[model samples]
Target: MSKTFKFFIPCDKAHIVCDKAQYREASLWEKAKLITHLAFCKICRKYTKNNTKLTDKIKESQIQCLDRKDKAAMKKDFEKALKDYSN
Candidate 1:
């Protein structure tokens, strides 16, 4: 494993690169190395596949979240209840 070919990245580093690649934050060289590593590493390949599937499922889910106004109202109500209970 020569430094020039950058052979055999560790599993920890590969997982980091995998995450970065998923988020489109990995550099070209890093992505290339990760892909190459995946070729021979079954665990990493499955991890990448599962991660991608999870991301896709999350994206497909149409779950709605409360906006700031609703959050603020809830906070206010909680605070009022706490104050009343304290007194």
Candidate 2:
């Protein structure tokens, strides 16, 4: 189609753009296209809403993670258990 009509995007592409937007990686043009798509696509709008909620929840949870030293210790223990089991 023509460049003027390029703003209209499909659901799959809109989903990708939505994800990119969530991660602050979408370009201005892509965000515009996604907005245009979301304007008419109810499914995509819901998807965007749910995705936003999930991101918000994750941020609010403030989850902690294991450091590299802790991970290495766990790996070593797991390997020892495996070796013992295989004997």
The candidate maximizing lDDT is: 2
Each candidate structure's TM-score, on Cα atoms with residue i matched to residue i, is 0.77, 0.93
| Off by more than 4 A, model 1 | 82-87
Error of 1 at 50 (Å): 0.6
The alpha-carbon deviation from the true structure for residue 55 of candidate 2, after best TM-score superposition, in angstroms, is 0.5
1-87 per-residue lDDT for model 1 (tens digits): 678567668788999999999899999989888988999899999999999999899889977999999999999999999999999
Reference-based lDDT, each prediction: 0.90, 0.96
| Per-residue lDDT of model 2, residues 1-87, tens digit only | 798788799999999999999999999999999999999999999999999999999999999999999999999999999999999
lDDT of residue 19 for candidate 2: 94
